[model samples]
Target: MAYTGETIDVDATLQRLNKAASERGFDCFSLVEQDGTVVPYFTRAAKTESAPRIYLLAGMHGDEPASPLSVLDLLENDLLGMGVDWTIFPMLNPAGFRINQRENHQGVDLNREYKAPTTKEVKAHVEVIEQSEPWDLALIIHEDWESEGYYLYDLPTELTDGWAPRIIEAVSRVCPIDLSDSIDEMSAKGGIIAPRLEDIDTEPKLMGHWPEPIFMHAEGKIRGTYTFESPSSFDFTTRIQAHNAAILASVELLLGSKR
Candidate 1:
């Protein structure tokens, strides 16, 4: 399926994803079903028990087409073959993706529904996390329509202290980095927003609508999480390439830390 800057065909995308998973020996499963639309997840285990368990998630916001597209690109190119236990949620909001909307069909933002999980999708995702082994790292791909270049939110941890910089450098090769001193109302340096855990804790409204990374941290599901934001204003190909580069760089960093 060639992506030619046209509206996405969600069914075709899922077909390609399933085919890639089958050919690559990844185990695929249905994560959840919402209004007859089933969201799928794929997993590939590492050869060694001590290997890091890494999670890759995309398509939380349907308007960010590049997020899921990048995951598909990586799967097709075998970029996810690195020796790490992998669990990938390729497209979480299929209902919203169908119409190119940020929110789901019910007008709920899936990304912000992780706290209470009022939506079926968030509930299902939370259940999977609770029933599975803890993840060492999670890489979430997203897009900001308001941004001019790539920027990321890194949950500050010893493992992620300098990791975002490396990711930014890698993505810069494919897309420009957001040089703004402030991004998303948070202080950012070198296109990276490394927020302290306590700082995140003080946000009053965060209790009601928690983003996925925050939910993962709050539940002790992952030690580190990086939310990569590609500029939606860029061309589709450039945005996809930028996301793919960041994901690969993040995986390399996590794997190196395990070694």
Candidate 2:
């Protein structure tokens, strides 16, 4: 089903996420516009200065409302209780979410503009990543319709033995991990697709025609990077739940790794 092009007040959504996080004793900040014309990117860190910072960003593409909604679910559930500093941008393209469009107000793909951030959305994301302490891990929530199943993109990281596989298994319990066949289809388009929950031991290719922004920004400093793609082919509610599952699983895996 096509997403209804109705207005989604992402600012309101951030307000809800912030309120919930605050009530749970988390440190929260919203980098929003003054006039409320744009959707502001908000980051929520744990109250205590913690070990490794974990960043979760969603809604780079306007049409992908599920990403932001999924993150909201985590906030409502007090998922941050799991630990690690969090920098979450629930919706990068506020205008796009309002109209269910794929790009930002400038009609530029925020994901593709990371190398040269053209829109305010990309700039804000860059600001958070650069300003925050070196992230130990990052999980960006995304959606793709051309694929038949869910997928993940594992970036080059230093510690892969226990961390990567744990994320894959955790996610797979909720959604079937895309096999090599699905990966082939996505690779045909350019890069490997994560049809189901998956991981990569080696560093992913970070430079090419359409390189990943996370990897480009988090090359040397970050310990791990991953991308979660929930297929829009599934029902919206199911897709949103899948996104939440991935987020929950990632947090658990990351926190468990430290122990």
Candidate 3:
């Protein structure tokens, strides 16, 4: 599952995001530096304070270039519809991307550190989560090096039904959904893996660390969490498009629900 694909331009990508976010009236800033790479956060309020708020995150794994690229594509093109608040972490692991590894230079996987964060990056991210309002939805972008195609991990509340199915339909337009019976060694039905809450807390595979989605569930940080996984072995364009399609679909669904 070693990702031997393209590596993103950390500096260039972030630069583009900063501009795009600013033009869209977003407030942007950075709070952490990992391995000499600055980590930035961008947030834009909804058309009204009562509108749904979406928290969008990408690029926690350095090898997942399409995660950040997908975010950049959406932001630059302004494809993300209006009326919903946006909180974005375009690239959480720039150092990892700079080195083309899953973890940062210190050998820390930022995703797992969210349960009990030790690294400054995760620590800062935890603060951001705690201080923010409960988001209507949080989309965590990722790519799977071993995946046959696109798949997703759904951690939805009682109210989050109907979204996963809609997301699948949207992704199907761009790439093949990995309909495997098992994904990431977890039971999957229709390209969706809904890990049991008990398993997340007790699973041996996690080694007692919380992925960002897990931490969100445990802390009640967001109402709905969908972690999109694109196939890294596939063509880069498809991977990027798949992630883009997934995210835009989520945004569209959220806005439509409010109407």
Candidate 4:
């Protein structure tokens, strides 16, 4: 089946990526739901024996088309060709993708349900991260409809040195940043930006509840995990460019800065 218009053909997209990996000799796998919707994942084997592991994910929210599409674009374009143990979970909510909804078919927000493991989608993502083990950095891509700017949520780690600053600066280069030091300032933007985990209320109904993957960083599970939100107001082509630039900047900041 072909993915007509701007919509993605999930199966064909996965096949394309896997075919690319096979042709280029990169490792690849699919994360699937109980109903058999194939979720694409790829692991690029390191060129050298010593390259470290890096994890990247997008589309935890089904409605956020930019992140998932961007993820596919990067994979299709061979962004992980560099020698590294790269694990990319391209999309988690295909049903949500189909309807352009934020939650899955069960109407659960996969992002908030991570702590409780109430949804299959969230569980699958968590399982992948746990199995991957130690990672130098984890980059999660996301998008917001009412966002007035772009920002990052980072936790403390050794990778925090130059890479952290670069991530912040590079995003600010193309979008306005909401730099809030206090909860009041953070909340001023209508909940588009993620507050520090400590500042977030875990109330079930609140968007901040249970916190997003940024909170997972403080748990010592992953050293540094960050989420980038691209505003949907931008034209599709411009949004795609912004999304791709962010991916390139992130990979270069973590992998290139290490060299």
Candidate 5:
């Protein structure tokens, strides 16, 4: 139910991040620091003003390396096509990642700290979110170490309703869908968990553990969001590919809408 895999070279992984971002013309800033580790932010403006503005994030939990790795693969291979302004936080819990643990070195789950952030990482991340413009879509990548296959959480605005199935269909080519009727204690259907957005106050999970996506939506900072979770028990390569497909599917939808 937890990540107990081989040791990871977090420093090396970050180095790859720096290189990939620089090569792709993204501007990297070390805007957040926690426990002597800096959480970097990457941004690239779309070539045209009409392009959609997108927000992408990964590696909230240190054990979920596949999430961030998928971003790295997308950047290194230039798979992220043009005409979309991008704001990316590739790794938020470098301290936890350094130790291969789920929480940060301080033992706080950064994702759950958005409501009242005690951890420096979440505080900085929250600050950035407040200052930024509302995104057309937000893509969050994570992995459930206990899950049997890939799944996603969908929080949509009117424009984005019914998009989760398209993403699932795309990911199905590379990964198995988690068809559980209940996922993460929430009712799910067809590999999608659509939380009751109107019941944030009544839901214990949303009330106590304010995830990044929920916080953004509650604040009206994102038009839509998808939290992709690849089953960590599966092969690393497949998990990464699943994340890649999920992201690409979202982008494909955005571009298709414009066309």
Candidate 6:
């Protein structure tokens, strides 16, 4: 089925993101050009060397409109407060977002382009990652249309213990949790899917397809990562709230650890 949900006004959204990033003292850069539109990314450094480096990404799937909206809401409210270095990729697939499709205009699923990175968007995103220092935690906000409640895919490392529960608890206040034992064909427990590290290591690197988390893990560039999935079947507001709560919870946990 085709995506008939509310579509994003890409130009207006970019303008708002640019303004917000500028006001928040973030350095904004154009990652790539797609159909004459420049995909933008933003970064804010920490005040101290001990501060945790966090990265938040959204809007990889154009059909999932709430992911990006939630990020913008957080930025507008200055939720990325002091004490942490942040890198944000607000929207990764502008061409797909322009038409409310999952894949880009060229029919490429940007999320799966990380391994091969034939698309300019993924290539440019990879460039940014290579240029920056490793991140302490990375959150990729997304939506699952077939899900009945919120779920998350956790890429565990030493720093990730007890985080999924915190995120689930926080999001539960705003949205229901996907209690299924299996999500996306993988075993899960209480809406949290913590895959074995060895499984990730032995996973085949299929050509032209690697999710962002997989790519980051394979490159050994991030200490931990979580992919939050809000059910798109629910109201848009609920989805946004769930995403925001999950993201904020992640930040709080990471920051609290440093204290």
TM-score of 6: 0.95
Once model 1 is optimally superposed onto the true structure by TM-score, how far is the C-alpha of residue 188 displaced, in angstroms?
1.2
| lDDT tens readout by residue for model 2, 1-259 | 4544233567687678667766766666556552255454545565555665777778778877778888878778766664567666667667777667787666766676555665665666666667667777778888876556677776545553445556656666666555544462345222234322222212343232133444344344467767888767667677777777767777777777777
Task: Summing lDDT over every window of 10 consecutive residues in candidate 5, give the lowest-scoring window.
Answer: 1-10
Q: How do all models score by TM-score?
A: 0.95, 0.79, 0.97, 0.80, 0.96, 0.95
- The parts of candidate 2 lying over 4 Å away from their true place are 1-12, 32-38, 44-50, 180-185, 188-212, 215-221
Error of 6 at 253 (Å): 0.6
Across 18-103, the per-residue lDDT of candidate 6 in tens digits comes to 89988999999998998788888899888887899999999898899898899899889888877899999998887888888899
Candidate 1: list runs displaced more than 4 Å. 1-6
lDDT of 3 at 163: 87
Model 2 vs. true fold: TM: 0.79
Q: Which stretches of candidate 5 lie over 4 Å from their true place?
A: none
Model 4 lDDT tens row, 1-259: 1112245565665566567655656666767763467776777768787776777888777667778777667766766657677777777777777666778878887787655676766677777766656677777887766655565555445665545556656666666554544322344332133345554455335444454464456445566666677766655565555667766777777667568
Per-residue lDDT for 19-80 in model 1, tens only?
A: 89768889999998877878999999987778899999998888888999999999898888
Task: Name the better of 4 and 5 by TM-score.
Answer: 5
Residue 193, candidate 3: Cα error in Å is 0.6
- Residue 112, candidate 2: alpha-carbon lDDT: 66
CA lDDT scores, all candidates in order? 0.87, 0.63, 0.88, 0.64, 0.88, 0.88
Per-residue CA lDDT of candidate 3, range 1-259, in tens? 4889888888999999899989988899895987777899998887775989889999999899999999988988888767888899999999898889999878898888876789999999999889888888999999999989899988857657778988989999989999999998899989999888777767987757889988887788788889999999989899889998898888888777778
